[model samples]
Target: MKTYLIATLAMAASAVAQPQKAETPSPEPSRPQMRAEQPAAPKPSRGAFDAMLYVSVQDPSMEWWFNVPEGFAPHISEIKKIFHNQEFSLFPFADNAKVKEGKFSISYSISMKSPDGSLTELVRGAKYEGTKVADDIMVACPDVIDFKLDGRFPEGLYKFFISAKDGISGEISEYENHIRLAEWSAPVPFTGKKLVSDYVRAFSLQPSPEALYSIVFSDDFDLEQKGAPNSLNYTYLGFMKAAFKKNMFLISHIRDSFKSLSDLNRAKFILILAILGEKGIDASALSEPEKRYQEQIRAFKLPDPYGKWDPFLGAAQIDMLWGEFFADGTYRPVRRILNILSHAKEAAFADELAEKSRAPKTQAEWDRYMLGRLYKAALKTVAINARKYPLVEQYCAWALLHGDIPEVSYEVLSPMLEHIREMKSPSGGESGENPKVRMPRIDVESL
Candidate 1:
């Protein structure tokens, strides 16, 4: 009985020991093996984001930038004008945005759309708009779908849309751009077409080619042609101040530049002679004082004393070339050269020469006067042979389409023979007299 009890107690003890020992059964290799077979768990997706937004005129001379969530790269590609569905593709810049990590920097240059309404590929001096960098939170990062719009878009609806990719699931999440553009007064003043017309009307009384030429030569000139925002150049207020100064200068120099003030009063003398010469007036037709002047003119042939004037713009051309043609009177030599060109029988050749003969004058007055003469002479020459050459008339019409000037009568114009005669050569070298012009001074330090 004692032996039986001891054995039983030993068995109980063994069972108790087994329970307390905590059986570590060959440390299940299953868990480690399963872990080795499984792939990595994906990263978590970011939560929804919302931000502010706004839209404004885009400047072609600038690079625009936008900030977006890293996963929204696919959505940004959609925003591009040339969108292509591909992962990790670069976005095309619409405006002149120099994109660096989706950051923007702009350049100073004019850009205009071509005739077909496509953007000009290169920078120009006559079509750029002013640039502004927006540091506002909305402008900086517009990737959020719940973005609130700033500024009122009065004329049209302002819209935005966004899409993002789920990093872990590789699923796309679309967002309707909730931001709407609000219409707000621009910080910069707006100068419209009406203002420009008003300015032209107010100061057009005593015409100066300088004013007109300045308008055409402006760096932002192309915008004016396309009816773009005039504010792109400068404020109307700023323009008015400069115009006032130009107006004063034009008024002061009207007599010297527009009226007959240069050339020893020879231009006026020629004018009187041409008027008389057209009426077939001779030496005997003049009164006592006029006769003396006529005698001097006849002896001097003062219209073109140097023969250089005659060969290019001979006797007949000199007689009919309007005195107003040379507003400064010093450009008579150039006028004569142009007259010789007008006599060319081939209208195409004549126009080609005229296009090539751009005057080398920086002053608006000089350039305008020369261009005006060229325009007029070209028109008159075409009109002279209107019946035989219809294309000449069409060319003249095209030239007149873009400009306004006094109407000319073909009956009053000089004959072709006279035009030919004026294009003759003189005996010898002419006198050395430089016309008034501003020459560039070299900066020695630059060299």
Candidate 2:
């Protein structure tokens, strides 16, 4: 029994020492796995913008003679009395929100819809790139839009639209306005007397230079009439000033228009030429006008004795011609000036004028007296032949004696004097005497 129990225990130990087979996990229904959630990305910012419109008008209070009212409250819904061939201006503004780095851009398009439902693109995709914000705000606009109502557009209501875009933030703004063109009317026929009266009235009303210009150059207006020359003298100076301030190009057209006038209207045309020279129009452009003036004055045949012609008119003519001569270095204008002086001297009016100059009653008389004094001064000065002296040098000598030099002429004279001083003599000397020394020196105070 002891041996059987030992064998049974050994059998049990051998069974325990032997390795047992591992049990495998059974697959019951396969399950899917879950992933961790991620946060969302941010959105881009949108900018703000607004639109504005302005009607540009001529206001002395503003620079460049134009006033563009700011803000949207004063926008015009209907433009009135838009006459044919009359120009008008509109300013479209883009009030944009400031962007990063103050960097922004603007693009605009303008269109006009006519009464017939036809659209005319006045401005297409006008773009201003790299525009910076001013005063922490970006109020951008393209150039002023100017248009005239002509035969192309019949008198009717027209719609104007402006589309502006901000390139930086992709913002767009739009604006619309309307204008009613007036019916076309024929200009009234004006006689010389009526024309002069109307022109004088226009000055007080402060009508645009364009309106006054139309009246002055009207087809029905007479260029030759009683007091016509004097009337121009009294009013044209003011007209020219206004026109020059408003538009410099108009002055050129006005000067050239003299070419169209009839030579029979001698006195009036002469006055026009004089006014142009005084107003500082380019002398080169006036060459043809000056020629016409010379021809007309010669045909005028001044009465043999100086007194035969109206003294006021004659003196006025001389005064006007003097202005031309002073402005022009050419010989033609000065030739006429000398001719009139010689005639008055021959007629012995100089002494009488000197006496009357002391006590002048009218503006015309005062002008005549001044001419007399100028003539007397010319008489006392030594004569310089045009052939002998260079044109600029002759003018310089005259200006020195007159005690005043016009800025325009001085610009040319100053450089010339310097060049003369630097010039080497024909003998190759280091120093040379100024040619001006040959001309007689007159004390302007004595004159």
Candidate with best TM-score: 2
Q: Distance (Å) between predicted and true CA of 418, model 1?
A: 14
Please write out the lDDT profile of model 2 over residues 1-447, one tens digit for every residue. Answer: 011100001111111111111122111111111112433212223335655444333321111111111111211221334555454556565554345564556677877787788877665776754434331243425345555454455787677778877776677777666666665333433456666545534332233334545555554434333554534442233333333343333444445655555443333435444534444334354467665665554454322212333444554444333322222223333434443333343234446755666565777666566556555433332133222334424433333323233333333333443433322222332222211211122222221
| Candidate 2: residue pairs that collide | none
How far does residue 387 in candidate 2 sit from its true spot (Å)? 49
TM-score of 2: 0.35
Highest lDDT: which candidate? 2
RMSD list, candidates in order: 35.9, 35.3
lDDT of each: 0.26, 0.41
